[model samples]
Structure formats: structure tokens, C-alpha cells
Target: MDDIKAMSFETAMKELEAVVGKLEKGDVPLEESIGLYERGAALRAHCDDKLRAAEEKVAKIALGPDGQPSGLTPVDGL
Candidate 1:
């Protein structure tokens, strides 16, 4: 859990992908598979939390005037 708390979204996502691949391969022992599934779920939850935080920040943004500075585009395919 501590490790997950410290992981960036991208890192967690990569680990989650690996976990999914292992589970899909169907070669892991049942007990190990269960553990992997739990880890994957945790990673997923962490990623979701990070995304929600990002969404909240994005929502608070306001576009500047045409002559003013322009930044912060829509998060496409989020």
C-alpha cells in the first residue's frame, strides 16, 4: 500500500498492465493469481484517484481572454 501511495499514475498503470497480462496468460498458480488480482485492483483504484484529482484541477481552470495568455486544453480521451 505504501508503495502504491508513492507511485505515480503512469508507474501504477504499467504495473497494472503487467498484472493483467499475467492473469490473462492463465499460467499462474491459483493462490498467486488471487494475490495478483488484489494488487491489480489496488493499482486500479490508485490510478482512478489520481485521475479524479486531475479532473478536479482541470475543471477549476478558466480560459484566458483572447489577448491574454492561453493555456490548459481539454483532456482528450481521458
Candidate 2:
């Protein structure tokens, strides 16, 4: 299994999609399905965090007096 913490947002999202597909098919054994569900949940949370962080960074960009983007602030812990 890959380290969820180290996985890129795109990678996590793709894996989560795959997990949903398998669960939707309803052909997986109960135990395996549970594992997949857990992993999917983690992936979902990670993706959400990544997206939220990105949104924050975008929002933090310095705007000029004319309301145009001037520059970006360094996002902490991103």
C-alpha cells in the first residue's frame, strides 16, 4: 500500500475513484470492501485538505488597488 500522507492529490483522487468503482460493482468480498472503504475515506480526506489548501493560497494572493492579481503570498505548510 502507498503512503497516503505522501501521495500527491491527483494520485489519491484517482485511487479513491477506483475504490468507489469497486464498491459500486458490489463484487468484492466483505473484508476487502471494508479495507477499500477505509482507504477511500482517507484518500477523500487528503484530497479535501489539498483542495482547501490550494483555495486558501489562491485567496491569499495580493490584489492590486484595481482588484487585479499582483502577487502571491507564500502559503505555509502547503
Candidate 3:
């Protein structure tokens, strides 16, 4: 949980999974569980933001009539 903003989507996702696993086992102390839950929420939000950015980029890909990616078009409001 060191500078989560600097973590890549993959790294954040992996950490989030670990946090969820610990929480699901129901064995962690209350204080630790709360910390883990908060971190998991932050990680989930970061992942969502990354995915949304990816979707926006994908939307800008222009396809030719032959159904192949021709180029990237300028996305509105991007």
C-alpha cells in the first residue's frame, strides 16, 4: 500500500485480491480487517478508473469497412 497512485492496474488488482482473500477467511483482527477493507476499496476504485480509460481509448479506434483497425480517431471530450 505504498503510494497506490503509482501502482499499475495489474499490481493494484493483485493486491486487491489478496486483501479480499484475507477478509473472506474471517480470521483477521478487527483493526487489521478495517485497514484491509479500506485498501481494497481504494484498489477497486483505481482499477475501475484504469478500465474506464482503456474503454475510452478503445472507443477511439477506427475500423475500415473490411473490419480492420485503420487508425485512431480523435475522441470527443477526451
Candidate 4:
């Protein structure tokens, strides 16, 4: 199995999509299908985590006293 933790979000999502397509076809053997399903679940979780982290970063934007956009605030616990 590939090191899923090292995979970028885009790469993990693409792999997860391919896994879904294969599973949908119902052509793989039972054992292989099980493995693929497990990997897909992991990828899905990883993607979700990455998205949540990104959202947190986006949420930390700072504004000036005039209400204009300034910059991002320091994201704690990164």
C-alpha cells in the first residue's frame, strides 16, 4: 500500500476517486475489493482533515481598523 499520509490532498482525492470507480464496477476479487475499500476510507479521512486545516487558516484572516482586509492572524496550535 502507498504511504497515504505523505500524499497531497489532490493526489489522495484522485486515488480515492479511482478506487470508487473500481469498486462500483464490481469486477475486482473480494479480497482486492476489501483492500481498496479500506484505502479509500483512509484517503477520504485524510482529505477531510486537510480541508478542515485549510478552513481554519481561512478563518484566521485579520482586518484593519478601517475594516479593510489586512493579513492572516497567527494560527495557533498549527
Candidate 5:
């Protein structure tokens, strides 16, 4: 779980994709398949959290004078 907490978005996505591939292959035993399913669920949650955080940052952004939003700013008190 700590490893998952430390995983980056790309890393999580890659692992999730690999898990899908393994599941699709249908060669894993029932027990291993269950374990992989749980791991995939955790990875999905982590990826979703990262996406939500990014979306919140996007939503807080203010448009600049040039009519384009400025780059992400650190959330106050974060």
C-alpha cells in the first residue's frame, strides 16, 4: 500500500494496464487472479485521486490577460 502511495500517475497506469493484460490472458489461477484484481482496484483509486487533484487545480486556475489560463499554482496552504 505504501508502494502504491508513492507511485506516480504513469507508473500506476502502466501497472494497471499490465494487470488487464494478465487478466485477459486467463492463465492465472483463481487465487492469483483475485489478488491481481485487488491490486488493480487500488491502482485505479490512486489514478483517480491523481486525476481529481489535477482537475481541482485546473478548476482553480484564473485566466491571464492573454485569454489563456495561467499555469497551475500551488493551492494555498497545501
Candidate 6:
């Protein structure tokens, strides 16, 4: 099995999309479909985690005009 940890977010997401496309095509045998589904689940989880980490990084606030760094604040009505 490939180590998802060593893969970049783009790679993982691309692989997941490919797997989903294959499954949607309905040409794979049942056994192959099951295997692909399992792999897709792992890749999806990895992609989700990477996205969350990215969102956290994006949400980080730099020092404001006061020159003191501030934590992230939620957007209104989120």
C-alpha cells in the first residue's frame, strides 16, 4: 500500500478523484470496486486533514496595527 503521509495534498486529492471517477464508471468488478473504495476513503481522510491544516494556516493572524500578534477570529455568521 502507498504511504499517504509521503504524498502531497494535490497528489492525494488527484488520486481520490481518479478513484471516484473509476467507481462512477461502473466498469470495475465488485472486488475491485471495494478495494478502490477503501483506498478512496483513506485518501479522502488524508485530503481532509491537509485541507484543515491549510485552513488553520490561512486563518492565522499576523500582528495588527498594535504590533501584537492576534489569534484567529471567526467570520461573521459562519
Q: How do the predictions measure up, each by TM-score?
A: 0.82, 0.83, 0.87, 0.83, 0.84, 0.76
Return the TM-score for candidate 6, rounded to 2 decimals. 0.76
The residue pairs found clashing in candidate 3 are: none
- lDDT tens digits, residues 1-78, model 2? 459989899999999999999999999999999999999999999999899878998877998899899998776765
Question: lDDT of all predictions, in order shown?
Answer: 0.90, 0.91, 0.94, 0.92, 0.92, 0.87
Position 32, candidate 3: lDDT = 100
Model 4 misplacement above 4 A: 65-68, 74-78
Candidate 6 Cα outliers beyond 4 Å, as residue runs: 66-78
Per-residue CA lDDT of model 6 for 1-78, tens digit only, reads 469878899999899999999999999999999999999999998989899878776666566788787767664444
In candidate 5, where is summed lDDT lowest over 10 consecutive residues? 69-78
Poorly placed runs, candidate 5 (over 4 Å): 70-78
> Which candidate has the highest lDDT of all?
3
**Clash totals in order:** 0, 0, 0, 0, 0, 0
lDDT of 4: 0.92
Predict model 1's lDDT versus the native: 0.90
Better of 1 and 4 by TM-score: 4
- Per-residue lDDT of 60 in model 6: 68
RMSD of 1: 5.2
TM-score of 4: 0.83
Q: Which candidate number maximizes TM-score?
A: 3
Report the C-alpha lDDT of model 5 over 1-78, residue by residue, as the tens digit.
779989999999999999999999999999999999999999999999999888888877877889899766666656
